[model samples]
Target: MSGKITQSNNFIYTALALIALLISASLVNVMPEGILEYIIEGFTLLTFGVCILSLRFDKAWTRFMVSIIICWLAATLLYRLFAIEMLDYLILVLMMVFFWGTFRSIARQILFVGDVDTNKVIGSIVLFLLIGLIWSIIYILIIVVSPQAFNGVDGGPWRHNLSQLTYFSFVTLTTLGYGDISPRTPFAQVMVYMEAIAGVFYMAIVVASLVSAGLSQTKNSRE
Candidate 1:
């Protein structure tokens, strides 16, 4: 019974964690520099820890991955304490891997394994957010390498750029293309359009999955 409850609420937990992370990041603009940045970084780490707990599995490999994430998280926090610039890259790479793995797990669950429940439907939304986050990490990585990768963005710590990049990522994903944050580098431009394509395909696939789930439920009722 506890396991069933956990399964049902897993996505809810993950969604809330992601939302907290986003909110904290979005508030960075209002926050003063120096110590506040570290505070935000700490909050980000806390939310990520929650996400890891919520999405963890009993599988051996999953356990191993979780261990690695925990270690990375610890190291990131340590680096942040010491004011290490390298921590920026470390955190971005760690988050990218974590988001990608969570996306895969949720996609397999909702797209392949089961009938769509409310939680599963929410999982689809989580997948969309994960895509934005994954691309945001990519964009940040590019910015790290080339400060001029984006016209409007400065080459700052990934944490400082998190909100803008995340906003740009989702904007590009939805093909809204407000043009406020244009990609300057050729590779960054390529990534922007690719994210747009992915967003379109993701919407179509989600609609199809919902339709299929509805049909399957109806068939089961008839049976």
Candidate 2:
């Protein structure tokens, strides 16, 4: 109710949003399939939990972008757990928003690391964690959703597809295109290609920014 309390709630929500992204990413990609999908679903609990939190949080333009991506990451993970179908175009829109928003936020943080402290530094690690998180969520969604659209036999290796999808998402997200498990459907191909471009641009921009900024800082330190 109070202004200070409101601000505090907002800050906490933003932080929690970042945390959910990291934690879900870990469960989705790093764990095995049997109970792991269920465990991964557990992360969806964070999504509902964060809904009110997301509403409460207020952020800067930069931080706003970061939080938007967080929303997509959380939503996609939830969709993965329950949707059990391939991504529709709307989901792709959300994914692109999440991907671009995350990429920009990371580039800003890495390039302008000023007055950053212990907590903020750990939070900074989310930049890297996020890439895996968002990609894995989408991949899982693809594996799960693609079945309903691409296959009719009610057999799509739900777990195995998810696991492979994780790898494939990162491969495409990173623009690696390993020539294995390529998309057979137009929907998958479109999603993969778009994500691949996003991935490539994100790295190009962020890495360049980091390198330039780091070099500049080094030169200043030497002076």
**In model 2, which regions exceed 4 Å deviation?**
1-34, 43-107, 112-125, 139-160
Clashes of each: 0, 3
Show the colliding residue pairs in model 2: 85-145, 86-145, 86-146
lDDT against the true structure, each candidate: 0.82, 0.52
Tens digits of per-residue lDDT, candidate 2, 1-223, equal: 2334242233344356656644554464466656665554454445424433433332354466556556656665666678734433344456546544544554454445543333334434444445655665565466556654322123254443444555666777767777766766687667778778877776676556556656776788799
Q: Could you give candidate 1's per-residue lDDT for residues 1-223 as a string of tens digits?
A: 2443277878887787788788888887688877656676677677666666666653643675576678677767778679677775786787788778778877877884568788888889999999998999999999988899899998877778989999999999999999989999899999999999999999999989988988998899899
Give lDDT for model 2.
0.52
**How big is the positional error of residue 70 in model 2, measured in Å on the Cα after superposition?**
13
Predicted structure 2, TM vs. truth: 0.49
Q: Per-residue lDDT for 152 in model 2?
A: 18
Worst 10 residues of 2 by lDDT: 149-158
